[model samples]
Target chain A: MSAAPEATWVPRRYRVDAVRPELNDTVSLELAPAAGEAPAFEPGQFNMLYAFGIGEAAISLSGDPADRARLVHTVRAVGPVSRALAGLAVGASVGVRGPFGAGWPMSAARGRDLVLIAGGLGLAPLRPALLRVLADRAHYGRVAVLAGMRTPREVLFRAPLATWQGRTDLEVEVTVDRGDADWSGHVGVVTHLIPQLELDPRKATAFVCGPEVMMRHTAERLLTVGLEPTQLFVSMERNMKCAIGLCGHCQFGSAFVCKDGPVLRFDRIARALAVREL
Target chain B: MPERDAAEARLIEAPALQALIDALTARGYAVRGPRRRGDAIVFDEVARLEDMPRDCTTTQSPGRYRLADAPGAGYFGFSPGADSFKRWLHPPQQTEFRFRREGAAFVPIESAPAGVPRQAFLGIRACEIAAIGVLDRVFLEGPYPDPGYQHHRDGSFLVAVNCASPGRSCFCTSTGTGPRVERGFDLALTELHDSRHRFVVEVGSDRGAELVAQLPGRPAPAAAIAAARAVSARCAAAMPERFDRERVARRLRETPEHPRWAAIAERCLGCANCTTVCPTCFCTTMVDRTDLAGTTATRERHWDSCFTLGFSHLHGGSVRASTAARYRQWITHKLSAWLDQFGMLGCVGCGRCVTWCPAGIDLAAEAAAIGDEPGAPSGSDAHAP
Candidate 1:
């Protein structure tokens, strides 16, 4: 029998329940599934958020993974589709395609000290993994989140960072590359904060997401700090057109970022990472 | 030729190929076959046997393709051309879905599935059939199968023609894909025009068996079957063996920073013609379009090439900043890394890349240069200390 493939690109309608401004250009859309329950997705996974006539962007699920009714995406207005998504009105309806790609390696980090590093909006995708770890605080050994923003204003989910910082057990380190007068924290690149991290190097598993340059730098520094390449994972951002890995935009050598990974082990992409234009 | 195959292989006159087209039409299929178009032979609709490029064959060299009229040539004389089942299957530009802005969000207008029309692809070469197999794995076997590709590929009928005149650039014999088709066809045809214009048909499946019964032809003589086999064997011998298929992936992945890459990239215009004509190069990008009032919109998945700078662009910039890098990525992916992604080699040895390349940049020459270059690092088990 000829098995005709069903359409995988069609997006299901979802209502933007609320559009809370996270930063000047970033908006956190609390989405509710129009029909049944929102698609159950793992932390570090992403959904293709479509801005109706605008386009689609691969936005990571930032809210609690346990919340089945709502899909939270912290979108930073970068490109055309992202700008449209960021400017989306509250109660506006949009299209959602996924819950695609491998989320952060949360299970692997169990019982190991977790080092979460974010550069710019790279923090958005990692937010879910951090929330997942915070919910089950007893499972993980030690949790440290290193975030770097362009300015203090660009720091996402500041309220939670403040709350988490008050806790002595969990280390929340936030830095700005070039902070203004209002900033009273460490001022440097994200990798600079890596040296200050006091976690046991052998047991520490770092999750880095940001610009390719930043990811490369963070991964290199983590390696120097006794984290093997395998122990370090990074969420890559590419021109992902088809979330299913068919469109070929997100191809990084053999790995299709949409399917095999948006999150991949640092060792796996090392050769390709060094290979320019791959 | 051995024991006169049980399926009743027939010796149908070359003209009788039209009857097959008629039958496919009667069964409600838009029959498409190779026909001459200016300096090239292309696949399009065919109603009569005369519509086929019987007397014309293509002469393809590196960076050149021209059709020439040759008297006393076989019915289907040319190697596979720039077209394949991809035109109808994984099309260049296809409107995936049409949506209208309804109040809050856009609602999809349930139109017929794109390119799922009942159609029959006639005169598909063995290599082309192999290409369809590659595309099938990519779009069908994956977890999220491409609906448009699957819709066209699954329902469509394939009638492949065995290669009797492979191009000068052809190397299907080495790739082990063609010279003759092994699978993925309803019917396989070998044009035997040695004595007189005729075709020896082998029924590939139940559908082919039924069609052969209705076409009014006697059982193929043992001599004609031998002639058909000889035709493909001749074509196979004509093709030059270039790349080492088994060791290609390993060699390419090892020599990423090879100096030969810069040499080839020197003449490479990065025009992307090779990728456009490549049947197996299935990289594509989506284009989102909106109406004047922004009430309606359509998303189109158009063919894209890896050589293009935009193909690898990420958040801030593209990974491939240099032409040398782009060329390296294309050849390495095509020859080597594809084996890791898809079990089969991505290069079908079609030679379309060689013929269509503006710089006459032969993949074989480039690959050989890397293999033979002095001081080139032999192995880079990257990440393996």
Candidate 2:
């Protein structure tokens, strides 16, 4: 007899090994497959995380690509499905169907000066790429990480940021839109930090992730700083149901953000992004 | 090729159509054909030849559809209604998967009983046939194919019909998708409504030839062949080609900020009736439902439209929040971006969107207005975001 057909939408069970609250609304989950080891994923690939009786949401793999034992996702309590996923306790179960979409251009950026820019919760998708790059620190030249937050209180991965900041090999700069009493870092948008970086602009490759407006501004700023459009990448977010490209929810013009990207070269989508509401 | 020769240009009287239906039923196929449903003709199960609608045609225009009696015995006289083959194949709502909670882990449970009966679609129009081909490119040829769609489509048989009566909203001639069945069908029929009630059958597959062999028919005379060609030629004459595909696609790609979008949005209700009636609009959303005990949950995929506010929702809010933006996305995707994603154009010029739209918004007219000219920088007011 013929084998039963596979249902691509059905997700495998993953036990929540750990859950770390990043902020008032955001939480990071470490999930291990219920049966075997978690499937390996690339730096920028994402998973459709199902919250038990709740629906699924596309969350990027925020953990290290080198580690295959568990899949990490940082989710914010913004929508109904995300809220339920954020509140999951350790030992709870979540459905996962994933490792979908194109990954960051690590091979292309090899031996090139690396720059990473992120805004607000967009840092979650970029965290895995950073981790991969840091693991192989000798792969490239000068490296800089610029992050922007709404406020100091909303900064995610504080411990990791502090650890990376102390390293002499890396440059980590963070800014917030509003400063508080205890804050002493820059008090402006992330684009302001782009010009301050001292590097060979012609030799550097940058990856940006943030809100749409922030990404647009960051792309424009990087271009003005002598970085070519081909040397820059951006992670896009859209409403996704089936991350396999069957559902047309995450369409960004001709490209399906779930498949053709979550990580796309700036030059590939520059014209599409310029069109408002596309 | 032998089967093609055996069944090519066979002329069968109107009453002989029952033999084909009987042969399909004998092979455990559920024959679905058009029948009068209220004021419209819809595809429904027909156990006999008489069950299909006859001597009736539809009056279709922008935002209007009316069923009227035509002076003929043609069974496939009416143009398509709001209902398309999508309603049966993709379905408005379908169960994707079911899960049972076992302690801290959710285990996959068996879905509904399998063995979807083989379906034979009869009285399908040329435009509808092209729409099915478009869907095949989306669901079957993608990197990750949908099992549910494949299960429903695998054993299906299609019988295409040439439209002798073109409605006012019909423009298949423009898209080059219809008025006559070309390639993609198991069997094609051209109803000869002149002087006598007969059909010119062209077999497209082995199964179609086998079914035709069981029927009582004669080799089509020269007049029958000429008559069949005339049916399509007359349809093309009735409806002039609306817009040049390459020109409109290029124009749409260049002008996303056209002012015509905002003007069209003023009349568009964003009701999504156009997409609902569309044969190839294949956007869907997943809905999860659980029992009161919470032990089991079933996930269902429901038909969704790009026009819905929630279709483009993100964490903070929707991307295309304004109706104008949604309208631009839908039409631009259909006319231009679809070629970039899939090799073929998304629209087959079925014109159901024009007829079913509550606001009488004609997609062809809007596309021409926005896409016939060079790109203009329509200031900030034109940008919906």
Candidate 3:
């Protein structure tokens, strides 16, 4: 097979300036413009990050969009690429491609109560959107964030969580799949925390991300609590090779996850969701 | 009714035809013609006309094809090769975008680089021409035309040869494509042998007419036309039995929950060899490579297959996690759903799926098995024989 020429290639790059360990195997890297200006990307858009010789993986920007001086990507080590990404030190070189894919509809949720549900590392992408909503508190109604981690030790953004917990405008609840000896917070699945919240589901737009099973069950739970399918958005994950529509790898029925969304309404992909293997 | 003053052309002697290829190359066209490669005759750029396989023929079955030396010097030696017409159109990989870091911001860059040269493809069979039509409907006529594909297609010329020897795997006649060239070529050549050997050339395009005018030959007589028709008919007669694609599409669309899918899944490995060999399969993936400075990134488009496990992973889990589901998705999409989307049958009945399949899976048999059933026709086996 003849190699495709370079002119048609999409350039997706950002520069990494700092790295901080968050939890076991997970670290947060701060990025800035390596040379030119960083491409303006939406809150939910992800970038294809290349780890020198380790290969590429899609990572969502974890920092606020307005904070263009630096972009943050929080990643959990899983594959070779992610492992290499975790090992990079401060000022190490990491290639960035996109802030690709659709992000949370923050503008539409301005006056609506915001319910952010994140499971494990799924919290990484939702953090930026949550911060955006929290920053502009008067535009929205009740704001609640229900974050689920594997354990207390695995919880990410601990420092930010501390500050958000002190605020009266945001109701932050943390849960774990299982608990350790020192754990004192909610020790059940994240879904368990949803019932205790005193918010009107009709006025709420929930942004749920994390494990596929968790998101499905969470979306189901949100429906039971009266959130409309349209009012609920979920960040989807797939082996997204191209952030463009050309690659058929990330297709969910007729939609390309990399293009149409990494974030989609529950109603949009319900049928594909029900299928056993896709 | 034929136009009175329509330009007419006749075939040159075999030696003279070789000379024409040499002359064309001397004028700067990259000449890609049929030549013996390994076990098959494939199209490749050649420096001289002598590279054309002059004495080769292929035996084709519903799911098998093998090239062999012909009884004598037969110019139209074999059926189409394993490579599809899409190879020249939608190349396996392309760059859709590029980026360079200027200071701290990444800038989006897009351009179409020129490398593929203008060339003439010789001995393109009628079935191959039909395959090109299917691809044109996909890439060129789509809402977004592939710039790279359009560039190569516009630059290339075609010389279609009427099939005088049908392979066992060929069912082009049933697909309404060939045994003869009705359209979609610059020049259509029909090999004729009587007192002497020559190719009766019919110019289908203005380019073909101009080229024919330059050849050292005369307009063919009425007898030569009859011989060409007879040869085409003989090839058509040898086509393997084909299926009704319309009926197959209808049957498949009517029955999405069919038992045949599970049965086929039992045998399918989900390797996606069929799609890879298919002339019109156009799925791709993108990847980004950043420079050492991490300031610039180059995103690349690569060919991807649907059979892989990770193709349909969402936040919760994979939608099509089972081998059976993937196989069903591929078949249903190709025969039934594709018709709804593209307004044409996805398969051209080339039988490459049957011949190239590692497990020797026969698409015709599978389609027949499903289409024969009454439970809403689960798997539409509509294929042109």
Candidate 4:
């Protein structure tokens, strides 16, 4: 076989200049283009971050959409690249490729009540969509944020949660799977919180992001509450290597999660989601 | 339009065949033909026509295959190898992207190589040619074409061989892909023997006819054509019992909770041997490797199987954590749901999975087992039937 073309070698890179620890294991890094303009990305789209020799990983963008100067990624240290990312200090260099995969359809939620459900590190991607809606509150109706963490230590954006709780325009509820002595809030799965909210199912749109099991259970709960399957959206996570469609690692059914979606309507993936293994 | 040619093509003797192969190489095409490798017959780069295996045969049973010595000179031997045309088209590993670091600033790097070499693959089985067609629908004609795959595929040539001997596990007839060449080849050959070994080569393209005319060979007799047909018919009759692919695809879409998945999953190691050997498995993963100077980072793309636990990892955990889930994902995707997306069957009935599997798991048997049983509702039936 002969050598492939040189056009295949170009790497898309963004720079991480600042790091902020949000929760116990979660750290948010602010990224800016090393040169030229920062790549404009959607709310739920993620980038593949390479920590030099350590490796590469798919990380969701966590900052607000209006912020063009920097890109923020909230990550938990679980694997090699994530661990290497957590170890980096401010001004440390990291390689980035793509603002890949489909993001949350904010326009689809216009003039509708928004229900945001997230668990553990899944809350990272939803944070941007939540903030984007809040920035222009008149475009949407009542906003409900339901977040669940494994423990009190894992709860992210504590400062923002307090602010959201203080606001009469937004309804924020927090839950933990296993709480410590200082915990003084709801203790149950994220799906359980769906019963507490009172909204017109027809007029509301929901966004869910978490483990596949958690997302499935959450979507089932929303359906029971009279929400149409089309009204419910979920963010899917897969082993995305390229963040582009070329590397077929992140395929969910026929769709490439890195290309078609990380965020998709529940009804769109209903048949595939019903498959036991996938 | 020109009337479809129905007359059988002429045959040429074995010694005269050397001149044809030489003519092909003289035109600067890298020719790959069958050769004995250990106990198997594999397709590899051949310098001359003499490199083709003369007297070798293969024994194939459900989940088993072995090469044995034959009585006479036979260019075609055994069954398909573990590697398929995928090794040449998609490749096992390739660089997708590269990056350069200039002091504190990391800049995007551009340095992809070049196009694939012009080559001709000789002695390709009819099933493999069909497999290539299946992949072409996926990587080329799909909504988004694969640039890397297109570059290699467009540069290569095909020379298909009719199956003179079918393996015990072979079921290309059931998959509607083989026993004889119908399409997807520049030239096709059928070997015959009456008094001496001769080959009946049919030109499928203008390029093939032009090349054949350049070779020093005589036209075949009517008796030679009859002998070639007899050999191909004998091979076709040897096809193994296969599952109803159309019915299986329908059932898999409806019966998501089939008990057969659990049974096969018990034997599956999630080793990815089946997908790796399969000609049409197109899943891949990416990697980034930096030079010692830390000045450049190369992003590499490598074949990845859905059988791995990490394939479905999310924020909190993986969706399909069990070996059972991974196995189910692979089988259901290949046989059933693939048709809905690609408008073509994913498998070519090559039987690579059956023979190459360490556990001796047969896909046809598994499909038949689950498909025959009445599927239960809900995901509670998590064990094998």
Model 1: pairs clashing at backbone N, Cα or C within 3 Å: A277-B319, A277-B320
**Cα lDDT for residue B280, candidate 3:** 64
Q: List model 4 lDDT by residue over B1-385, tens digit each.
A: 1222435355777776677678778877777777778887777877777787777788776557778888784777556667566687788887766667676656666544574577788888888898888778777774446667877787577888898877766778778888888777777788776577778877677677778777666565667667777877888887755778878777777776776766777788888998998888888876668888778777677888888887777555676788877777777778876776678888888888888888888887787776778876754233332
Q: In model 4, what are the clashing residue pairs, if there are any?
A: A3-B114, A4-B113, A4-B114, A5-B112, A5-B113, A5-B114, A6-B112
- After superposing candidate 2, which stretches have Cα over 4 Å from the reference? A1-7, B1-7, B378-382
Lowest lDDT sum, 10 consecutive residues, model 4 chain B, at: B1-10
Summing lDDT over every window of 10 consecutive residues in candidate 2 chain B, give the lowest-scoring window.
B376-385
Q: Which structure among the candidates has the greatest DockQ? A: 2
Q: Indicate the worst ten consecutive residues by lDDT in candidate 1 chain A.
A: A1-10
Q: What does DockQ give for each predicted structure?
A: 0.49, 0.59, 0.17, 0.33
lDDT of 3 by residue, B129-226 (tens): 77777777666674345566677786577788888867666666555677787777877788876778788887777767778777888887777877
Q: How well does chain B match by TM-score in each candidate?
A: 0.92, 0.96, 0.88, 0.93
**Each model's TM-score?**
0.94, 0.97, 0.79, 0.88
What digit string (tens of lDDT, one per residue) describes model 2 on residues B138-198? 9888888777778778788998889986889888887889888878888889999778899
Residue A275 lDDT (model 4): 68
How many pairs in model 1 have backbone atoms within 3 A of each other, for residues 3 or more apart or on separate chains, i.e. clashes?
A: 2
Report, to 2 decimal places, the DockQ of model 4: 0.33
